[model samples]
Target: MATTASSAVTASLTSVTLEVADPDAAHRFYSAFGVDTRIHLRASETPSSGFRGFALALTVSGPATVDAFVDAAVAAGATVLKPAAKSMWGYGGVVQAPDGTIWKVATSAKKDNGPATREIDETVLLLGVADVKATKEFYVGQGLTVARSFGGKYTEFAAGPSSPVKLALYKHRGLAKDLGVAADGSGSHRIALGGTGSAFTDPDGFVWEA
Candidate 1:
């Protein structure tokens, strides 16, 4: 008798691609900002304005690391949307990259346990969708497992061992408020997700590919 080998059937986010007007410049900025290894870049003149309906986040170990990232980003030409500070949950700040991508550097630790380092614990892609419940269902159909969910307000997907980025969902207006930006946005999302399945677009128009 012959037996067939089987593998776990699951969808995971393998990569993230950002479409920018100038790949070279974007490359420079990301490299200097110390996250070039986390994202891929492509050249495009896609007209985008306002919030872009998404934000990339870096989870670090402590407040010092968060400050280091924010300072590096600003030095690399990113504009400070919110200066680093301590909040009830943690210390964090928001910055807009030179290519117009919103980035949030944060940590749940209120203070540093050790010396500051450029190490990033996790990279998260937060999509601000119209309906969290519907979008969560869409990703579920694509085989993504829910790691966490909060009613119709937010949802988080479990990342596979090899996945480079984690995925999450948030209400459009709530996310905009958290990022201190306007909720209204139009044109391309300027971002893409690489998955382990066939290419498709999500309910909120987030493009994903195998």
Candidate 2:
């Protein structure tokens, strides 16, 4: 029910960051998703921020559509962490970005909508937070519009219905566990999100840049 208000404290998402070893190669790979995102370059030998802690969700037409897009992503230099499959929520697959970020391309429900074009549709950068309800409340206070949400579990926020990239938060341990990694440990998540603030850190330590 929260909406972006007029106050300056209202933080709006601008771009999300992808930390990669090679910016150029990462650019080429992510270009397949058809979204322009920010990239932060790191040493080539630097290790990945293990467990992903977050995921980029691509909402498409249906199951087959998800498969086709997942295929495209694999062809674009991604590693198939999980193959396309169906779940109660819908059908989706997990892929590790060339830079080691996890992504989930899926549909909300079942249908025979076929495949999508070369370009992907709406993308949601989901952050795995320690507490979804508190994180949701924090962002709501920061002036983001909560397009849809459920307390203590998940939150989806955007500028509007057609907004291309939305910022969301899910229960962190659940997310890491879902991605097949242990839900404990600390490391720079290697992701950045643009928002209006004095550059605050979330409950789970995800940093938002002003």
Candidate 3:
């Protein structure tokens, strides 16, 4: 029998590369933020403004770890988008990196179980799409299994064991509101996704490559 698209693993995101104007400065910021190993950087002069239609989220073990990352990022020249605090979902904060990447460091646990640690539980690349349902279907057709979905609002894909980052979808304007930015942008996304399949662009213009 022919393998079904849902059962076949055609694409698996393995790495996230951000194109920045200054890789050296970005490297210094990421190193101080303690996530230098989780992402790749490249030099580019793409003219992008407002919201970039995406955000990189760091899931940590507890509130303490979230605070640790937020503090370090702020100390490394990152601008605070949202101050870390307890919310209905958990504790987290948002920061804009020097390279213009928005990062959200969060934890489901409302309280710390122990001292803060540098360990990151998961790294999620959230793409803001014009149509969540359509984009979800496009990725499903690309052989990415849906790990979780909420009607037409949001969807999360199961990352393969070897993949370094998880993928998720959110509505464009909603994502901008969540990230505390205006939903207006032009030019390149300045981001590339390294994956396990042939190169393709998603409905929202996210580029993925093998």
Candidate 4:
């Protein structure tokens, strides 16, 4: 018997993130596709001597090429927050996403004696809201369980396995307002905030994580 003309349906796939105002919306869309999620804590609360900052750990081919890529990202869709500049310790620059998440792109400052190389880096995304409880519930219903709870005023939900992108909720007026900075939906830049995690603001006037 001759095989029928049953052509396989092949589609080009380019995976990109969806930036939605409501976390619940994002959760529902991804969950329907059966996507797994996981949360990763900061590499360390007390980073090593040369660990620098844990904002966004994107490893680029070289420091010079970092800014060019960041610029391209901005031109494509990302919102450029901090222009690419050589960090204090050396390496690359930090840029912000349209959703206000920082992207720290850089090359390895440590010596590479072995063939082992790093590819994908971790980036911690901050989700801000007026009410912490309400926000947490929104993520929960979407199938993302709280991986870490700060108790005081923050909780993180995992996005995917091995990805350190955190969905955090924080108080609006606690740190940003306290610093005498007005909320313009993106907060007043980023603050170390005296902790293992970095500080970030949301599109709204709410504080959370980076």
Each model's TM-score?
Answer: 0.95, 0.82, 0.94, 0.36
The local distance difference test score of model 2 is 0.71
* Candidates sorted by lDDT, best first: 1, 3, 2, 4
lDDT of 1 by residue, 1-210 (tens): 212213453888899999999999999999989999999999989888888999999999999999899999999999999899999989999999999999999999997899999999999999999999899889888988788788788888888888778999999999999999989989999998999888999988899978
Error of 4 at 151 (Å): 2.8
Using lDDT as the measure, which candidate wins?
Answer: 1
What is the C-alpha lDDT profile of model 3 across 100-195, one tens digit per residue?
A: 999999999998889999899999999999999899898888878887788678888878878778998999999999888899998889899988
**Candidate 4, residues 118-169: lDDT per residue as tens digits?**
3334334444356666766654543445656665466655445433344455
Residue pairs in collision within model 2: 10-142, 11-142
Position 57, candidate 2: lDDT: 79
Candidate 4 or 3, higher lDDT: 3
| Alpha carbon lDDT of each predicted model | 0.91, 0.71, 0.90, 0.41
User: Candidate 4: lDDT of 188?
Assistant: 35
